[model samples]
Target chain A: MKQSLFEIVSNIQIAENVFKMVLSGDTEAVKKPGQFVNIKIEDGGLFLRRPISVCDCENAGGSGKGTLTIIYKVVGKGTEKMSRMKSGTLDILSGLGNGYDTSLSGEKPLLIGGGVGVPPLYMLAKKLISEGKKVSVILGFNKKSEIFFEDEFKRLGASVKTVTVDGSYGLRGYVTDAMPKDAEGKDGYTYFYTCGPEPMLKAVYKASKTAGQFSFEERMGCGFGACMGCSCRTITGSKRICKEGPVMEKEEILWED
Target chain B: MGRLSVDLCGIELENPIIPASGTFGYGYEFAELYDINILGTFSFKGTTKEERFGNPTPRIAECTAGMINAVGLQNPGVEKVISEELPKLSRCFNKKVMANVSGFSVDDYAYTCERLDSCDQIGWFEVNVSCPNVHGGGMSFGTDPNAAADVTKAVKRVTKKPVIMKLSPNVTDIVSIAKACEDSGADGISLINTLLGMRIDLRTKKPVIANKMGGFSGRAIFPVALRMVYQVSDAVKIPVIGMGGVSSAEDVIEMMLAGASAVEIGAANLVEPYICRDIIEKLPEIMDKYKIDTLKGIIGGAK
Candidate 1:
């Protein structure tokens, strides 16, 4: 992981309580699409750094400098403080967590995301499309006002399907309601990747047709795996959600009841 | 040795900035960010006789100027730590490492400490008797003087290394516990582990941590830690390793002046990641500003 000061390029509210923040920093340490960054919001009351996934990135090649785009919901005091800031350098620990493995995406890959989980999938979708694979995305939101990045995924050359629970916009169910059933068909997805609330992830896990990957969320201490505060039981043993994964393959996931 | 160096149980540290147990992991995790040899010596993760998965999810809860964690001494057991963690740590860290052992029983503490004592890299065995998250074992031994002494005497029997009894601050008399351990042959003392604390989620109306309560530490606990360090250091003759929310070079110097021979950076490492290295680099500058020549001279200066 690389600790660097990221200059806030832009901070704007995109959806209801959701924000898009652009930071210019040394992005050389970020290796994969779904990897995260732990940002320290300099607030008097806050002690722990907030871990946010890299929504998108522009690498400076070998120069070791770049721009990072992160989307976060103002959930607590830390993110609430982050949203109020328009400028200033943020001490960020970049290139954290084991990101998604794009190599496992065969030909036609399906991406499913819910709420704040949609941010990481944006970069994952970008990587998959750039690799010449056919990408299909299903974005989920609670209501019309809560929806975000619907057009951004479409602009990345991925077939986008926006789902809302309230029937406020697009399909009137969930991301699982949009999954194509046949895995062997020409249009069927060869693999699937998902990130969302635990209930949504569980629904998608049961509804998925192909072996895929899922990104997880946990209350983390050190987003770099040292604290063991975010550890969860996997089939193999215990793994830190920040280190061994923010992403795990479908076969390896042993979801808790 | 350099001016930053201080004697920690006969083994001299390059500096007084030791990263506390649970915060530093096996040492190699932070080694990915910078050379960890710059630290005096860090206490590794809390290990037990049996491998513990620890408390359930939502083990961490954020508070004002601190965090409450019910991690409950999750580890790969003593065997895996020796076979897996140590070998990985030995690659990046060249200096001796402090081993922090926690247990559900007095025998469990002895077993884990005895097993880890065989490792050559271990400089001190920090026996944790102050974990508040666990059910019956951890903080139970620390709240009482006799139980604290019992665990200390049992662990001291197996290891020749300096046994630092890590005391919890949740007790009525922290000094009594420290004195008990010292009287029972504890080579040194380390306090305060963490203040027993809890946080309630406003939305859920339930505890933020799944375990309901956790050990709280951060910048907020520094004064309480310093006060306890003063009291414990004054009560006991052995070296005192002070921790609990230590973040800066100023805090380290403050801890030493309050009677700590060495200070451990806890939650600050989670916030800064480079805090130990930053504190070590800044110690000399801070010292020069304070007109202090040697860190060893400042021990208990405030007293």
Candidate 2:
């Protein structure tokens, strides 16, 4: 992990209570698509750094200075403080968590995301499409106005499906309701990858036919794995979410009720 | 020894900045970011006789100027720690590490401590009698002077190395417990572990931490920690390794003035991964600003 001061290029509201922040910094350490950056908001009496997964990144290799794109929901004080920032350096620990493994993406891979979880999958879609693999994305939100990055994903040469529970746009109900299945009633994608609330993940886990990867979220202290504050039980016993994951292979996941 | 050096028990630390256990993991986690050999010595995660999964998710809660953690002492157990973690840590860290042990019973403490005593890399055994997150043991022993003494004596019997009893701040009388450990053959004392604290999510109408309450730590608790260190160190003959919200080089000097021989940076390290290194690097400049020549000279100097 590398700690650097990222200059905010732009901070704009992309959706209600949601933001798309573009930052320029030393992005040399950010290695993969699903990896995250922990930003220290030095205001509002916040103590711990807020961990936000990478939505997309550019020029992030070998001493390359790059720009980072992150989508965040203003649920609490930290993000609220983050949403108000116009311009200045924000201290951040980047290239954290075990990001998605593109090598595991088979020919036809499906991406499932819900709400804020939609961000990380943007870069994943870009990666898989660039790899020349057929990519299908399912973006879930509460309603139409809450939807984000749909056109962005569509422009990435992937088949995009926007699912909203209110049926205000695209398919109705959850992402699982739109899981493309073959005549054999098996999920059509060769493999699947997902990020979202746990409930949606559980539904996707049951609906998925092929093996996939799941990204997890937990309240973290040190987002780089030093503190065991974000531990969760897995098939391999206990693993720190910040270190071992924010992403885990479907086979290793042991979901907690 | 250089200006930053201080004697922790009989072991000489190049600096007094020991990363408190739990926050530093097994050392290599942070060592991956920077050279950890710059630290005097870091206390590894709180180990137990058996592997612990700890509390369920939402184990961390954010508070003003600090955070509450209910990690519940999750570790790979002592055997695996000796077999697995220490080996990984040995690769990155060259200093003699401090092993922090916690348990549900006196025998459990001795068993884990004795098991780890054979490891050469461990310079001291920090018996953690004060973990607020666990039940049946942990802070239960720490609240009572006699129970704390029993665990201290039990671990002291098994380990030949310096036994520093890590005290909890949740107690009504911190000095009595520190003195009890000293009387029971504790070579040193480390305080104040996280104070018991809780936070509630207004939206959910529930506790922020799934465990309901956890150890509150960070800059918000520095004054409470300093006061406790003053009281405990003044009461005990053994050296006090003070911690709890210690973040910067200036905080380190203040802790020493309040009767701490060395300082451990806790929640601050969570915010800044290189905080200990930063503090160790800034100590001399801050010391020079205060016209101090050696850090050891400031221990208990305030009185």
Residue ranges of candidate 2 with Cα displaced over 4 Å: A183-187
lDDT of 1 by residue, B70-120 (tens): 999898899999999999999999999999999999999999999999999
Worst 10 residues of 2 chain B by lDDT: B25-34
Clashing pairs in 1: none
Q: Give one digit per residue, the lDDT tens place, for model 2 in A94-159.
A: 999999999988888999999999999999999899999989899999999899999999899989
TM-scores of the models, in the order given: 0.98, 0.98
* Predicted candidate 1 versus true structure: per-residue lDDT over A1-257, tens digit per residue: 88889999999999999999999989888889889999987878887889999999999223566999999999888899899999989999888988999999999999999999999999999999999999999999999999999999999999999999999999999888888878788768999999989999999999998899999999999899888999999998889999999899888899886
- Clash list (residue pairs), candidate 2: none
How well is each residue in B92-164 modelled by candidate 2, as lDDT tens digits? 9888999999999999999999999999999999999999999998999999999999999999889889999
Candidate RMSDs in order: 1.2, 1.4
Task: Tell me candidate 1's interface RMSD.
Answer: 0.7
Error of 2 at A184 (Å): 6.3
